[model samples]
Target chain A: MDFSQTAERISLKFSQKGQSVDTKKIEAKLRRLIEEFGVQPAEAERSVTNELAKEFNLPGIGTGGGGAGKPGERENRSIADVTPGEWVTIEGKVVAILSPVSPSIAQSGIIADTTGAIRFVVWAKANAPEMRQDAWYRIESAVIDEFKGVANLKIHSGTSVKPIVEDRALIPSILKVGELKPGIGSVRVKVVQEWETTHERMLQSGIVGDESGTVKFVIWKEPGKERLKVGAVYTIFYALVDEFNARLSLNLSTATYMQDEGDITVSGGDSNVRGAVVHIAPGSGLIKRCPVEGCNRALSRQNYCPVHEIQPGFVYDLRIKGWLDDGEKTYNILLQREVVESLTGINLNAAKELAENNPLGMDEVFLRMRDTILGRYIICRGREIDNRLLVRTCERVKMDTGEHTALLNRAGGAP
Target chain B: MSNGGTPAQGRKEGGFEREPARRVFAGELRECRHQFREGDDEKSPTFVLLPTGERSNRVFLVGTLTEKQRKGEQNIFYRGRVVDPTGTFFVMAGSYQPEAMQQLAKIETPAFVGVVGKPNLYQTPDGAYLVSVRVESVTIVDRETRDLWMLDTARATLDRIDAMAQGLTPDAARVKEHYPALDPAMFRKMVYEALAQIKI
Candidate 1:
């Protein structure tokens, strides 16, 4: 069959020098065989699958044994005699990336290649240190991890690794996108738009796209802050998945993390996953009225006792409503007087002056001079309760550079 | 009549006028001394008290009473304000009243009168300030009040939510899809479920 069109589509989703092998075609052929025979679908499909395996010189069905090759059972290769927990190394091009949110899927993940995104076990965070998407690396004995019915090699200390960074470069022929998942090392992505904060400066989520797919990325740098140049592309690495908000999500946490790199870029992954961009609205933060430390009670009128009624009293507290993000979600954060004082250089007196002059208050002044803040990206790892969602923050590494360089840094990141 | 202007003098209860009211013991010893002045009368407007200082989480004091210096009356309330690091609270007092005098006389040297009246604030002509709380009968209380307040405060501290990790849930393992599979609110809802069990 002329699979040129199918191959081309894979190229758009995967990468340039590489593309995913068309699993759909294989499945389709297997289904046809099943329909033609009166036997069980699994039985008919396996028989036909075995014939194709021989033609492609693929490992024969149930070759490695001790473990039975039953229906829905792992294929026991006869020659390589490996156990379920045993680690083995497979040097292959990364077929497909789980698209930042696949680990929690089906209890593990599936990285497709000329083979298909297979279930791979990455038992710990440190395992798959070098096996990024679209890159060629030697994956040692990653258990058979499954996701969405697909199989992949799991990364673990028990497993092995070595980087052949440019497996994409080694391939002599043009590759389609579908075949590029295993090859995902780093890919250039454009910043489409970022989600603004309501309570204060923080990011909810961001959308970026490439020729392959478009996906959403959440931020907590500052709710209403974090300016992004539209269409600015950067590289992304090692972002996997977890379950979030009832459905699955591309989690950029401990297991899966994303970075934006300005220089080189990679491609997309998976047939069903579409990288879509989102334009979320900005959020709001509460403004506070400040009081003078020594003379504040006069305004309160009722809080003053007999003594202050004679001499003059001054002083008051300031507080406001802010926002925090729980992943790509938003939350309300209460900015008390102490927190405000620490965050802003202004003291109680200066803030009062700012408040007196502007009806919006001191925070508004900070917002107006926002070039110094607001848009700055921050690392938010520590989690706190914000509104209802947990607002998380960690130390972020920020660099003074052009939009181009900033994105490049993010692109070259690891989990 | 605690807020009704008077020095620390007299008690109308069964203790009845208890002794005519002495000099130091005649008036209530005020904790927030910032409100007192020499030439003030028995009345001031209103005032506010933020839950600040040592008693931060427990007290929110706002009262209406006479600042000794208001109405240009000469009174003896040496101090007027209490600076609870959280914020300052003002106290207004003068000489004495029949009821207040009763308590002052019975209590030993300068003692605290757990205020029963609200707060009163008065703005002076020269931009000075006078703040105080009307006095009520003093009661001696202890620890339980403090604990409940602390509990209320701890309850207010908020926490954030992240999505579920692999094997995070004790049960349920299903093949996850990235796109056609991404459900944004599901994790948030899961967090709510977890939070439901927690309370102060």
Candidate 2:
């Protein structure tokens, strides 16, 4: 057959097997195989068709295992050894059970054996037995299939799933950093870093760890309230692991909490930052705050704080939302009332007077503050919360004329 | 149970760690309208998922300051138009945005500038969305900086395109699911053509 006829036949076979293959990809792969191997056209066609059939687990194709076993009752294969189009009886524990949400699909989740883990799928029409999580089940006549390059088991009506009690000790616990998945996970580690706070909200973020290593963590309470002191050992429960720029950060919500296991020094993690003030964001000017003690909430347009709710005694406050670029990474730096006042030398009283004088005068004050701070290199000491630097203290980096000239040159300009 | 490993910093619940700004053309930014929150919680970070599959909260762009105007009779804010080879970006800095507004006020039009800011989306009366930048910081840079930003942004855009090709990111998969007809090669060509505009 010609190439187009061969492609047509392969597409037809895949459709009959209830699988959708990228016809273009198959045609390209077939062309590459023919060109590279220099095999006869008819032989290449048969090989491509057979391979695609096996990948989709269609019946009547050879198991391709090359093992001497019975036609239907084959010896158990390891999780990794289970190939597409092969049927085998395997004993393994279901690691996780995922509820299939689509109307067309049924149940699916991850199942692992001694060798490795693979996803298992049972179609809605298959009417297969339920696979309980963390329980060992001996699955007979389960066909292996490939989905997106990963080998998976397809439990059809022909498959039999029998529960077998196994020792729970064989299951893994307390995921290491390497074993961390993007779902509920627990880690036991010393508090390597204590609470870092952002002034915009009473939020805390820091690092937690054990020898398998540490990961970033964020809790939505003040450090004092969370009692997350540095160098303390705690078992952090129910952390939602999230990937930021390929690095994992744990989010501790109401469902998540930590148990203190006393003091233990965790070496090597600190967040002392210094960088040039590259940008100052809006909300960096005169602002009103919630009157309630310890509630430094920025009032909404309705003049209400979520916690305090339209109190008559709201006070004026100062804050700055700025960016600091330290050559490598840019940090969102938030300076609270005191830091803003000290850095710009604009007290709250002066800010109020400026606002009272003219409607647009407060804009001018913020403009002046921006002029004073932007582009200047400064050292900042604080903890990071919510991916922003919560500055406790800061000072400008004094640049000599020579240093100034060097900076200007690097910026591609002359002084 | 605590497992030990290297210590990494944590990010806040509602806030995301600020992503590095991506240099992009006006056309690409204008075309991006889909915005979604990453998590269901109140603190979940919202991101503007681009057609090229990049999820960004902040973008770094360098362009020519083509025009400037004062908007809002009651509020009195500054709006500047910055353009690259593809299109223009409207950067708005109000009284609240003191630094960006002052920089826009002092700088002359038709001069090169670098702006780092958050992407702001507004829906108009005609049911179409308008894209603009809430300027965080705007600086009057030279032509060289403009060229460097273009190259960097093009490289970043290409990275996203490559990711789509490899099917490595969920954003890429979502792009395919949402915009089935989008030709990724078109974005790749757009980046290369954008890079070609630079003399060096």
Measured by lDDT, the strongest candidate is: 2
* Residue A79 shift from truth in candidate 1, angstroms: 19
The deviation in Å at residue A293 for candidate 2 is 15
Model 2, stretches more than 4 Å misplaced?
A1-96, A110-120, A141-158, A170-175, A178-268, A271-273, A282-321, A327-329, A334-372, A381-393, A400-415, B1-99, B102-200
For model 1, residues A304-336, the per-residue Cα lDDT tens digits are 322234323334454433333211223333334
CA lDDT, candidate 2, residue A61: 42
Candidate 1 wrongly placed segments (more than 4 Å): A1-60, A65-89, A93-143, A147-151, A155-188, A195-205, A210-214, A218-231, A235-238, A241-354, A358-415, B1-200
All predictions: root-mean-square deviation over Cα?
27.5, 15.8
Please give the TM-score that candidate 2 achieves against the real structure: 0.44
Q: Pick the candidate with the highest TM-score.
A: 2
lDDT of 2 at A173: 43
* lDDT of every model, 2 decimals: 0.32, 0.66
